[model samples]
Target: MALNDESLQELKAELLDELVKEVPSKTLLSLRLAETRSADIGEILEEMIEDDEELPAALSLLDILSAERAANVLGYLPGESQLEVVGKLDDSQVLKLLEEMGSDERADLFNLLSEDRREALLRRMAHREREDLKRLASYEEGTAGAIMTSDYVSIASGMTVSQAMMRVRQTAPDAETVYQLYILDSDGQLIGTMSLRQLMVARPGAIVDDIMIKDVISTRVDDAQEDVARIVAKYDLLALPVIDVDDRMVGIVTHDDAMDVAESEATEDFHKGMSIGQLEDGVSRVRLWSLYRKRVTWLVLLVFANLFSGAGIAYFEETIAAQVALVFFYRY
Candidate 1:
């Protein structure tokens, strides 16, 4: 059932009460929590921390969730809360949570951490994950590489439907999404795409290339996330492949991630429209100077532009006085 505001608040209170109990109603709570949305659960944790009360209870909430789900909820929390909640957890806890986080999300969170904390956390992650994290985190913010996840389903174009299906099955567990599959050449270049539905219905003996759509919509890793989102939205794609300078496939930005990019871009535009600086973090958490830095340039430019216009008018005042009679007939 869809929960109203009052019901959601009650659910949050119930969870907080359960979490704060001496023994903790872990089992009973899980049964109830399973019915709640991750967004709502995140909201509960956020509500509990508005006054910074019940942090331990919030930690308990995080603990009850599996690593992946915890990461999902963590992504929903504000940056400061994310750091605070992670600070309460041990390194092992943090490691497990980060391991299960999406590649893009892990990079975003890792970028926010202190150097010492970053190194410590990186040390605990497996080698593959650590390497992937570095590669993704190295990309400039707002770029496709920074937002794309490396965990995508890729299949050889020559593989038969059966073989491709087997590969999809094997990769699904680790893939961020398998609903849309990329077809790659031997050199790891994305050549086309095939939907999971099409793959399933194709003849078992049919080659993947025969069924794959050759006109794939994609973006470069260095392209802006906004550009990637636009391509996905225009093409009604579930995912957009990321290619390198050499046209080799490296990752994909899933539809959900694209939607997030779209929202962020729209919000940024709104902020700019209001003449407020677009903040990377929420308004509550940004430093006074940081806000000033982002806003001052635009204000200063506007001031100078107006000053130039005023000066030009002042300089033309004598001419205007002489032409006062002409002003009335200056329609042309």
Candidate 2:
């Protein structure tokens, strides 16, 4: 079952009780967190890190988890929180966590590091992983490539159903979603797509090209992330394939990631509607001065606008004097 807000709060309270002990028991902490979800864990960590007194406990809690689990939970943290966690870890330790993260998320965390730290980490990484990180990080922010993950399953054209099934089994472990698969040619260009259900029901000896849908709906790498989210929602796709200028399959923007973009965009629009500037963090976590700065500009302008009303009223003083009842009606 999904955890509601109350349950999350309860979990955070219990964890905090354990974390604040003089010498927290690692074994007990591990068992307590064993069944918790990554997103939930991230939320708890965010709360802990937001308090200066509990920062050490938060770091200790992260250290107790295995590297892969830590990386998974770290992906759910906001940018500021993510940096705070990474700031406490050494270069090698941070690299280990980065290795376990998904391609897109890894690139994001890498991009957040300072120039010297990024150079240090990049130097220690393997050739292939390093190249992939640089390529993924090279994309402009707010673009499709920036949010897309290279971890997707792709079947080659002309492969038999039996062969394709075997490939799926091999790659699905790392893929963002195996429900939708792209079919590519020898030149590494996407030519078609097929659902996992379609492949399962087809004859083992049949060619994938014969069964795959030739006309695939896809987006370009340089497209706006907002447009990508719209396309995902419009077609109700589980994942949208992203291609480069050469028509080569680069990565995919999973539905969850696209929805994140949509929600963020909606929040930004809401802020604009209220005449508030974009906030870098959630309202509760944002600094008081930042909140004031975002609000004061619009408020000052509206104050000036209200002064015009007083000027008009002054000009109509004689008219109001003739009709005394109209003075009260001006409040409307």
Candidate 3:
């Protein structure tokens, strides 16, 4: 059974209490932290921020995790917490964390950095990593390129199932997903695809092209992310391939990222429905003037619309008074 929020909150309290105790059992704290979910840890960190106390202990606990785990947890934290926490990390530690992050997430964090800080950080990364960041960051915020991650497995068409299997095994550790494998041509065009199940059951000597699905479902790099999410949902896909104008495979948008995009789009629509502007953060966190700007424009237009409506009614008053039934019907 899954733990309820109450249980998770209790666990958080226990960890915080341990942090305060004399001779704090680092071993126990470490074990508990390991057992907690990254999202829950992020929530705990958020609570620490809200209290303005226990913040040091929460930050200290973050340092105890491995760079990869820390990065994962950090990704779940709010934007404000992310900047503060990242600022506390040493240069090397920050680099390690960024390297372990998914390309889309790394791009998001990189975009948040100031120009000078971004340049400084870029200098520390390897040539390939720096280039990847630059490419990923170039995409518009709500496009497929902005959400897609490059950590996907791909192989050439001529490779046999045995060879493909070997390649997948070699690359799976670094890939974000391995369930769906892409088959590419020499020119790096996505030619076909195969699921892990098909690969597992096929004869070792069988060529990938023979067993792969030639009808691939993919989205363009510049496609709206909501449209990409619709594709994934419509096809019941685990991952959808992203392509360039030339039909070459660029990256894959995993199901999880698709869902996030869906949620974000829905939230934006919800704001529009309520006559409020689209806001990625909670209303409490938004600047008061910014909120006014989003709403006041619509409100002002509505006032004019109401004024026009009143004017039209006044113009028709004599006609309405002659036939009161017309007024009732029109109002109805």
Candidate 4:
């Protein structure tokens, strides 16, 4: 059943009280609780900004909301206020939030932060998490690897279906999708693949090596993200396996990540064709002059190119006048 407005408000209030009093700040609970809209809670939290010690609490409140919501609220705040909130988050918290965020969304946020802030956040993250983010960030903005998550399920091919199922139960919580399982050889080479349905119906003692499909559709790490999307859409797949140079399963790109890649690629192409570079969401929070500076570089280059086109048109004016009567014939 849907939660009534009054019930949501009461829950929000209880959550807010807990956020203000709980140890370690009940970060996850606050995030889950604020999933329901509570404008009054937002307003109350906004008012606490005036209190010096309340900054952490206010930032925590914003962090608990969805990333898009946080981006929207941050956009509405003044530059100083926005920075104050972002500044309070440590690198680990920022990394956790980014990990939860969609690829384009995370890139947009990363673009907004200063280099020092970005470096600090990366330094604070765990080594594996940091490498994952760096490898993702390194891909061209429109590529598949840039948006794909490293979270996925993989098991050794020698394992029986029952053994794999046990591993899935233990690891599913951290995986982005568990509908498909990737089978890897002993050297961590991706050898085959299996679906949850197949795994479920297979004999408990049957080895994955015997039942898994060896001819799995996969994409290389360097493959264009657009190609990845086309493959997934064409196959109607829930997830696409990602492999490295050695043919090892590095990660799986889930359906949600594929959708985000398509959307981001579309947006970037639109902006580029219009002679505007990609605009990150945080740009809205920056100063008007700064925003103009970001855009004017592209506009200036386009203007100069247009000027050359005008010159060429002027040079052709005499020829056009001489051939004025030819215009109607040309039209035909």
TM-score, every prediction: 0.83, 0.92, 0.88, 0.61
Listing every candidate in turn, what is its Cα RMSD in Å to the true structure after a full C-alpha superposition?
4.3, 2.8, 2.9, 7.7
Cα deviation of 87 in candidate 1 (Å)? 1.6
By TM-score, the best candidate is 2
After superposition, the stretches of candidate 4 with alpha carbons farther than 4 Å from their true spots are 1-60, 63-85, 91-141, 271-332
Each model's lDDT: 0.86, 0.93, 0.87, 0.71
Give the range where candidate 1 is weakest over 10 consecutive residues by summed lDDT.
Answer: 323-332
Error of 4 at 129 (Å): 4.6
For residues 125-189, what per-residue lDDT tens digits would candidate 4 score against the true structure?
77876676667666666555665667778888799989999989987877778899898888988
- Among all windows of 10 consecutive residues in model 4, the one with the lowest summed lDDT is 71-80
Report residue 5 deviation for candidate 3 (angstroms).
3.7
Local lDDT at 15 for model 1: 84
Please list the residue runs of candidate 1 whose C-alpha ends up more than 4 Å from where it truly belongs after superposition.
279-332
Q: Pick the candidate with the highest lDDT.
A: 2
TM-score of 4: 0.61
C-alpha lDDT of residue 291 in model 4:
60
Instruction: Give the distance in Å from residue 2's predicted Cα in candidate 4 to where it truly belongs.
Output: 11
Cα lDDT of model 3 by residue, 138-173, tens digit = 999889999999889999989999999999999999
